[model samples]
Target: MRHVLAAATLAVSATACVSTATPDTEPKGVVVDPISWGPCTDIVRPDGEPPARQEPGVRCGKLTVPLDYDNPDLGTIDLALIKIAATDQSRRLGSLVFNFGGPGGSGVDTLAQAAKMFDTLRTRYDLVSFDPRGVDRSSGVRCGSNADMDAYVELNTLPPTQKTREAGRAANQRFAELCKRDASRLLPYIGTGNTARDMDRLRAALGDAKLNYLGMSYGTQLGAVYATKYPNKVGRVVLDAPLDPSVTFRQRTLAQTRGFQQAYESFLKDCVKEGCELGDTVKAADANVMRLMYKLVDKPLRVGNRRLTQGLASTGLAAALYSEGAWPFLETALAQADKGRGDALIYLADSYTGRSKDGTYTTQMSSFPAITCVDSAERPDEGELTRTWKEAIKISPLFGSEGAGGICTSWPVAGNNEARKVNAKGSAPILVVGGKGDPATPYQWAPSLTRQLGNATLLTYEGQGHGSYSSGNKCIQSMVNSFLLKGKVPNQDVACAAA
Candidate 1:
């Protein structure tokens, strides 16, 4: 999902035939037959070769969920699931479902690429994931082609002027309209709360006593909502890179604004130590970046068929800031852009906005706002938005405007759930992880969220990255493994050294 610094899928099962006798129900009294699982299909690699780390016994299936949980009989939608069954089934605890950020990220795709990352868990429990409704492989939204999205994401100016603001407003409205036309049925049903409800149904269908879950980035929000809605039913849940759920949309942007700024500073310090060619000093590098951003505003750089604009450049930088691993690549992109070669930065932007090489989008941007906007209570009118626009400018001159809410203002509907602190009182002890250098969900969010919940433990990777456990940090991995497999929470906040 492309965050207009709008911030912000998934599978189930491996090679086992699992079934339940209890029938699935749709609201009121519509009793549907029990869901049946069998052989998985359509597991092909685009490159014509399987990934080196494919899950050994992965199984694929579809679970039918109510399109509208409020009125289950309203309709039904298919949530595609994939499971990597535990190699040591005799020692299996239960299913450990995982969500890899992006309200639009395909869990099946991500888990496939990083199957080895979950190797430790696969030995103890089956790893299950599902494409949330409105995400890829589900009944997803398709608003525009890659060309249309490219133009939208690569807008040149900030929303500082009425004309500029109107331009963003129009694009947002256009996207909402396109979604209405392309995915009207799923639009009203898409939201964090609804997805959480769907999760409960999935839990029942899977025959789990409770849900054992791991959610990253936006997935943290999903897990939080689930815990809030089903506190008593909660199992072991790890929310990595979490959000301060009580905050409003504008607040969310401000958090990211400061977060990206700090993460960039961290990158700069490392850059100078590594003797990268960014600048001689920190001040010079900062000035160079600001100047380059404004330079793109007045005169965009040509990258193949597209011109790299200020927004694209900013988003590219923001994307790279998610992990310190990308700092070197970001330095190279910036150095090349300074020298009038914009291809590298363009690729970064493409990765951020979900534009494929074939000139089509993957429904990320379309579903991102639809789900995010509806999940919130705030629906600022034009006046409040204009004020937010100015505040965004003052916060981070390079990204403030985009960091704030421009896209959600034009949302066709207000979300079903109101923004508030999630107490999750009856839920069991839950683990919340944060990365100090995480730019997407700032490190502070972990503590803030921990304080909000009734029995939440904070785990900090006093290091750089968006997530901790799966990124190969031994301490973080051990803690997460113990929590999931043995239902143990750290006695106190555990801080791990940088990887």
Candidate 2:
């Protein structure tokens, strides 16, 4: 059921502590405060675990934004924010905002965890990020209780039988109903369009004439939409591991399936060469993984008081595939699972889903369906869903259930989904980075997004994983640094060999 909606894309880190309150009257401008910053305390894991580490000089605060931009009288919600100032103030550039993939990912939390990656860029630009509306600590959406969510997330969306299919449909309906009950007020205004508007407001507040941004995965979608709406306001933008918004829902799903299939096969090939315990041949490795997936469907593997179901297992595998660095952990998890120990795979699954040790879930999963369902208007008929599911399995039997009927089909509100033909005609040159082996946001999307932008340069990472710039590739890093730091757009598309 985790993949029943669009692919969750990137794995985010950390959380923020913020609160919201409304004013007696509408403000003259965008609903906002002066953003009084302080030391970090509540940066959290998805499961409510306390943050492991908090970087010094990294300040946390809240930005109050309109609950409804068009109808400003509706009051306001607080967006969680984090900022690390530039090191070289004498030559400091403007703030560089970032959105790291999940439409539901916490920018504040992610910025906190990933700030070290941008130390060189931080020498000039103030690294900033926030939780968009309807994300964790930003009036985040809530569907049901912890127990209810557990049952919902574990539902067999890839039902092999009619009964399981019916059960899954029932769960989807219930989940949607719960969302409507819990977060109806915030649902309509949380789409990417409003977020783009919010970003502009953020820029104005930061005293910047234009926005400099680095967006990855789903964040690229947010960045592209922003450029289309505020082309004149775009400064230096980097869209890494970009998503091709022009693709139809089915096309995206299938393409993602193929991308992951390729990555998974690549992993298997490596496992064989490394003489991993999984197998000695690619076919055998594939069979071993598939065997584990199929076996867990009915015979759940015990992990203490919990069990590793097929849904969670699939999610864990997909999560590991997001980054090549996690391949070793994935291999270990797979080997452990083969011996009837599900702890390792379960740990990976919990990390992906943001499940805490306390059995509470993070707002990421709840907000994921809420935002994606509202953003996507596609409600394929049962026939179409069945066809998509069949086709997706063919693309990758391991992850094919993702192509089945998604939560959006049963959502209470109809999405105002557009064709997403973004052409930021007057925007500054955008640097689009694509990973050749990106599984979530396929490498092809990099070039596709490049074409979609009115002005852009494509940087292809001839490598593996979900994102390029964060892969620690000096070539990718150098090119992206030049683009953002110096505003130099390459005359032609560039490709960097995987490190």
Query: Which candidate number has the best lDDT?
Result: 2
How far residue 256's Cα lies from its native spot in candidate 2, in Å, is 1.0
Off by over 4 Å in 2: 1-32, 45-48, 157-164
Query: Pick by TM-score: which candidate is best?
Result: 2
The estimated TM-scores of all candidates read: 0.88, 0.92
- Model 1 stretches astray by more than 4 angstroms: 1-55, 158-163, 418-421
* Tens digit per residue, CA lDDT, model 1, 1-499: 2211111211000011111112223345534334465555544232223345434487778888778766867978898888888989899888888888787776765665556678888898888888788988888877766666777787755535667767777777887777767777778778877787778877877778888999988888788777777777789999987877776666777777777778888888889888868888888888888788888888899877679898889878877777566678899999999999888887777676666556666667787887877777678787878777787777776666666556776777767443243667668889999888777777877888887776789999988767776556799999988998888788686789986
For candidate 1, what is the lDDT?
0.73
Model 2 lDDT, residue 401, Cα: 63
Any idea what lDDT model 2 has? Answer: 0.78
lDDT of 2 by residue, 455-485 (tens): 8889889988888887778999999999889
Candidate 1 Cα deviation (angstroms), residue 106: 1.7
